[model samples]
Target chain A: MEINGVTIEDTFAEAFKMWGSRLIITAATEQWAMTTAQAATGFGTSIIGCGCEAGIGRVLGVDQTPDGRPGVEVLFFTTSKKSIAPVLLVRVGQCIMTAPTSACFNGLAAEKTVAVGGKLRYFGDGFQSSKLIDGRRFWRVPVMDGEFVIEEEFGMQKSVGGGNFLILAESQTAALEASEQAVAAMRQVPDIIMPFPGGIVRSGSKTSSIYKGMTASTNTAYCPTIRQQVESVLPEGVNSVMEIVIDGLTEGAIAEAMRYGIAAACQPGVVRISAGNYGGTLGQFQFHLKQIMA
Target chain B: MGSQLNSEKTTAVSINDDGVTLRLKAPITLPVEAESICPDCFVGCQQSEILALPVFCGRRRKMLGDIFSVSGEASDRITVEGDLTHFKRIGQGMSRGRLTLRGDGGMHIGAYMKGGEICVEGNTRDWTGAHMTGGMIRIRGNAGHFTGAAYPGEIRGVNRGTIIVHGDVGNETGARMRRGLIVVEGHTGECTGAGMIAGSVFVFGKLGARAGAGNKRGSIVALGETAPMLPTYQYQCRAQFGFLGVYLRQIRKWGIAVSDDLLKGSFRRFSGDVTALNKGEILIHD
Candidate 1:
């Protein structure tokens, strides 16, 4: 199947189960809130090296927040539930708490929760206090500017990670432009985040590498410069490729993002749309490219 | 003060209903014990049975039917109408359901309440929501002293729940409260939050004299005029607190008017009641 003269690969994208949590970071202003959110979710591109995959989900209005402040929603995904607590503790305590006039709140409502603020309350140094509003507990830790208010616990749930689509284009500019357009469209969907820089990954990796101790290596087959040195998967005219990876609270959300992203990427000079997988041997979920578009 | 009802009747009244209503038959001059008027008591009984429930009027034992006209089937929601200034214990120990008082309530209206919601359309006397553990109590008018407070000799009061008073309250509101939130939109009598163990009392109007006296780790926030602090309390600092905005915004959601200035304003913090834990704070809006 194809659209806009771009071939839609019959292959599916393999995704694994992950544990995810969402945080609502708010500050004195929208710019500050976005700044804090960016700082908190920064350096989180892939769980393999960064310990988690995180990105800003959306910007929020005052009416949409718990404290009636301009805010941003950020999502974090870890490979295991047990690791989510430590990852959040470091990110929220080091990143969010250090930001000016910022407060972090749990954005998800799940039965399973991890204590983030409860542990951070120690920063108050015997002056910490708590308030229980509508059965939800929030901690107030005194800070130099004022106080950092955060919910006592953050909810976590099983999620989906590594839902991606590849943009194969005839030129480097074409691939980059199509990838940017796809990322912009996919970002509009809720409960999902494209974890790579600018929501596009230029270095798409394979499951293994020739170098020792390397869990992942470059996808040589799709690399334009190394096409002659490797078994190239690109068609005759294809010269550049970029991938957009998605992580979301649910499988359906990932699929929805991928559908919008693929359609947006299939533009001028794009040769084909494909997905990377381990031949369907790994990952609990598989998103068939043609089936998703259908 | 939480009371358990007959198991069989508890099951009977658990069914959903349109709402049971009780109307006073005539004006009374003496205080009446109407604890049986609670939704838990009327849940399983028919209108006739509800009227047959016993009540103590002054020194006389009387049937509820003799004092008021009860209508509707057993249900979780109850409506009481009349001048209930003499009626006491109207919603004592109730664990569930909605109870609305169209008229003024006497003492102990929602003492020991565990769940559900109680909306008092008129004023209420002292001991409103005393010892309540859960649920919400909204008084649209002024409330007498000891609102959300512990009964004398009780160790804790209103451990969990919320009490919102739209008008001025008598002295010692939220006294000895262990936990929960109490918001008074108008001026308060003297000694508000006195002997508070742990809780929060927000007075939007003038705070009474000697507020937060003997407080043991609690917060008394005065958003309007504040009286002079006692010698036991010491000056802390003047700054903005993030938690206050959260609480104020939540109060606004409950239909209470909250100004933008108050929502974004800073407060002068005074850590006091040094005579006790010395950890309690009185925040005067700056």
Candidate 2:
């Protein structure tokens, strides 16, 4: 299949089940909220190094927030439910709790809960107080600016992670440009986050590595420079490749994001749009490119 | 108090009269514990079974049928049309279903109720909603003292749920409440929210003297004129609280009155009672 003159590869994007939570960070102004959100999600592009993968879900208007301020919704994903609290404790305590005039609230409601402000309240050194409003509990921690209000707990839900699509182009610049456009398009969709720098990952990996001590390594077949030396999957004219990794609260959200990202990546000079998967192994979810495109 | 009931109605209980039909065949000469006459207990009872339920009239164990004339089949929704000023412990421990009281209610109305809802169209005696764990109690008329207050010797009052009083309430409203909300639309008697541990009390009318005297971590929001505060409460800065906007929007959905000024105005924050936990706050609208 082809869209916008770009060929659609007959591959599927493999996604694994993950534990995730959404947080709404509000501040005295939009700038502060965005700053705090960016800080909290920074260095959180991949769980391989960063304890979690996160990205800005959306920018919320005053009416959409609990605190009646300009806010940003962020989605955080971890490999397991047990890891969500520790990851959030570090992210929120260091980033949002330190930002000026910022407050945090749970963006989603689920049966399973993880401590967010409950564990961070100790920063108050026995001075923290809690308030219950409309059946939701909030912790007020004293800070230099007065008090930082954060919700006591956040709801965690079963999520999908590692939903990705590859943009294979005739040149590195063309691949980068198409990936950038795809990222920008995916950002407009809600409940999904591309947890990579500019939502583009150049170092897409395979399931296993040939090297003795490594679990995962680069996809050499897709590497433009090594394509001649190794088994190359790229069509004849394709020279460069980039991938957009997505983590979302639901399968539908990831599917929707993949659809939009692939459509946007099918631009001029782009040779094909493919996805990374291990022949339906090592992952529970599969998003077939043709089905999503159709 | 939580009262659970089956979702499907096996019976239907309704008041047979149009006005305040006296459910009781004769006026009670003594105070009776009418706790059994609630939606939780009558949801699946037949008229004969409802009358056969037990009640205590001043230490005398009497069958409910001997006192009141019940005719409707039992269901989840119960309506009592009568001068229930002699009835006590009505809707107590109710976890589900709806109970409607058409006339005056006696003391301990909805005490320890955990779920469901109680709507009282007439005045109620003291100790309304005492020790209630969940559910909602909406009193359309005046309430006697200790509305939503803790029972005697109990450490907490209403732990969860909401209580809305559209008319005046007597002394110590929300006293010792640990959680949940109490909103009084009219004047509240002296020492309102006294000894409160945590929770919120929103009084839209005149607040009585020494409000929130011994509060620990609760919020006493006085939208109207209030009496003098205790010396233990230290005056803090005035600011517009965003939580009030969220709270007002929620209570408005329940048909509670909210003025525009109260929703948009700044409040003078007073942190107290310093002699106690010193975490409670009194937010007087400025």
Candidate 3:
């Protein structure tokens, strides 16, 4: 399937079921909200090593937030239920709590709620008070500046991870530009996030590595693009290949993001567009390149 | 709230109301010895969580099957269908599920609600939703003193959740509420939002004295009033806060009738309680 002279690899991206939570962080200003969300989602690229994958889902308008403040929606995914609590405590505590005039809330309200504020409220050292409004609980912990409000518990639900695509361009600049545009487009869509440092993943790993005690192998197929020639080679005229990874509340959202991302990558000097699929993890539904175009 | 039952010899049956009463007909005798029982103790009689409750009843801290027969499903819902005039702690520290009282209930319909909904079809006594973290409460009829207010030693009333009363309430409505929205369709007693750090109280009817004393950022909407409010408040002219409209509309869908005047009314913003904390402000109707 060729789209605008760019080959859409007849392959699929492999993904796995993950436990996910959406964290809504509100701050005094848009900048603080974005900064806190970005920082919280940073370094979370792949669950392979980072233990989680996350991204900023959207830049929320003040009117849409619970506190009438600018906010950002962040999506974080982990392999297990137990793995989720630590990520929440560390990320929310360090990033959001550190940010000025910021408050955090759980985006998902599900059957079972986990304790986020219950764990973090101790930062106030018995100075925290809780309020239940509309059947949801919120805790107000006294902070140095004023007070930090967070939901007493967060809802957790099943999510998907590792929905990814590669951006292939003639020059590194073009690849970077296309990747940036694609990320911007995906950011507009809700319930999905790109957890990489900057929504761009330069390192694409195989299921496992050849090295001892290693679990991930580099995708040598898209090298040169990297340096030093290896067994697999990059297509000619392909100066760079950057991957866009996605983690969302649902598989449909991740698939939707890939559609937009691949379309955005089909610009000048682009050689091909493909996905890192795990042979046929997608069941019952497949997002075809031709279908996406139509 | 009253329900007819045929069970006899049901030991330690407790009806949480004005009195934690346990009564047995002369035909049946309860077996539990020592009293001062937790509600959980009654469940052990049949090893079930269903405890019959009324608004007010006679009790023996050291008593057995004080009032009525206890029977049926020990489900998440605990329903009482009697003349619960003296019910106390109708729902004490209920961590989950629904608790419904068919008739008027006495003090503390829901003291500490962690989750779920509690509906009082009839009027209720005081201290409702005290220190609650989650869930909702709707009192179809009037309520007595401290509806959604704090206990004496405590400084705040309801910690979280929403409380909607269809009728009038006694003194200290939502006293020291840290957060949450309390809507009273009828008149409210004095000291509403007293020492409140944050939260909102909407009284469609008249509000008595000192509605917002020491409030940090909470709002009290008196659609009809005798605003003998504290002098600490410096009135900041009337202006409509859009959230009030949204909130009123939300309650409307939930079956709480909040008059149109409240949604479209101009509110007087009083930024004070500076005596205790400068952060608090009282948003009152102009």
Best by DockQ: 1
Q: Per-candidate RMSD vs. true structure?
A: 1.5, 3.8, 9.0
What DockQ values do the models have? 0.69, 0.37, 0.10
* Candidate 1, backbone clash total: 2
lDDT tens readout by residue for model 1, A177-216: 9999999999889999999999999999988898999989
lDDT of 2 at B209: 91
lDDT of 3 by residue, A1-294 (tens): 777788877666667788899888987689989988888888788777677887778788856767556788888889888899999888888888888878888788777567988889888885465555465566777666656888888888888877778887888898888899888877767788888767888878776677899867878777773555576546777878999888878888877888878887787777877777655754323455555555
Worst 10 residues of 2 chain A by lDDT: A126-135
Q: For each candidate, what is the lDDT? A: 0.91, 0.87, 0.70
The chain A TM-scores for the candidates, taken one by one, are 0.99, 0.98, 0.91
Clashes of 3: 43
Of 2 and 3, which scores higher on DockQ?
Answer: 2
> Candidate 2: where is the Cα deviation over 4 Å?
A207-218, B1-30, B56-72, B242-246, B259-264
| DockQ order of candidates, top first | 1, 2, 3
Candidate 3, B148-171: lDDT as tens digits: 777899876677788889889888
TM-score of each predicted structure versus truth? 0.97, 0.89, 0.63
Which candidate model has the greater TM-score, 1 or 3?
A: 1
Model 3 misplaced regions, further than 4 Å: A207-218, A225-228, A277-294, B1-181, B185-187, B190-286
